[model samples]
Target: MKTKQEESATDFLKLVKNMKYFTKLKSDNSNGDLFNVTLKTASYNELNLMVSCLLKASICALKNDNSGYSSASESGIDVLLLLEMALQLLPDEEMQLLDEFHKNAIDRKAEQ
Candidate 1:
């Protein structure tokens, strides 16, 4: 039997996978050229790290208690940090695509 933490981790991973698939589908539907390049050259490890941070941030948001609450900025910062880490890991060619994605994310936040 898996421990509670392990089960939660597994569930989080599944959630992240589904989110990635949806994001990819949305990207493909919106911008075929960008989707094609991202699908072809994206780093799985970086994606995984980004998803993990997102999941954690989501959990924090949901668990807002009397002590304090998680703000959108907190989550956004975490994601940006992960993106920076990913950029460092990727080659110059791939970094451009990641930068585009990062800019899109920032734009979405500004719109919200």
Candidate 2:
């Protein structure tokens, strides 16, 4: 049996795998879908999937409302915070590698 944290992580991973696009529809001029997101990693994409899952989970928590004092909202936020902390445990070099990837990605886009 899996612990709550494990279950949460698993749920997040599943969500990320099933998600194909990300967009914020705001106006009639919107293109519906914005950026093309993909995850690549040395661990057969496991690391990418984990990071993507945490990011998506955090976003989901933010989208939940607390104005009505909903318990679910609190739970969602807690999950996000915990996952963020877990990610922080990654080695500094790993985080730096992630930063480099982002920088290279932007540079590639600039050439387009």
Error of 2 at 103 (Å): 10
User: lDDT per prediction?
Assistant: 0.63, 0.64
Global lDDT of model 1: 0.63
TM-score of each: 0.25, 0.33
Candidate 2 TM-score versus the reference = 0.33
lDDT of 1 by residue, 25-76 (tens): 4445666664423434367676656656656754555455323665546555
lDDT of 2 by residue, 14-98 (tens): 8876884333333344465543334345683576567677777765665554444455455746765757654753457876898
Q: Which stretches of candidate 1 lie over 4 Å from their true place?
A: 1-42, 65-112
